[model samples]
Target: MSRRSSFVLAALAGALMLSACANTVRGVGRDVGNTVDATGSAVRDVAH
Candidate 1:
């Protein structure tokens, strides 16, 4: 393969990997937020 083609492929792969990492991080943040909300709700219920 040509050097240009290899560079392009590498760049594309890097972009894909970065995007996947971003999505996974976003998902983890949401999961953490949900857990916090649930915990707060449980505490409120128990206090009531």
Candidate 2:
């Protein structure tokens, strides 16, 4: 393959990897938020 083609392939691969990482981070954030919300609810219930 040509040098240009290799470079393009490498760039595309990098982009795909970055996108996956972003999705994973967002999912982690959501899980954390849910955990906090659940914890707060439990505390309130116990107080009442």
- lDDT: worst 10-residue window of model 1: 1-10
The digit string of per-residue lDDT tens for model 2 on 1-48 reads 999999999999999999999999999999999999999999999999
How many residue pairs in model 1 have overlapping backbones? Answer: 0
Per-candidate TM-score against the hidden true structure: 0.98, 0.95
What TM-score does candidate 1 reach? 0.98
Q: Estimate, for each residue in 1-48, the C-alpha lDDT of model 1 and write its tens digit.
A: 999999999999999999999999999999999999999999999999
Task: Evaluate model 2: give its TM-score.
Answer: 0.95
Off by over 4 Å in 1: none
lDDT of each: 1.00, 1.00
Q: Who wins the TM-score comparison?
A: 1
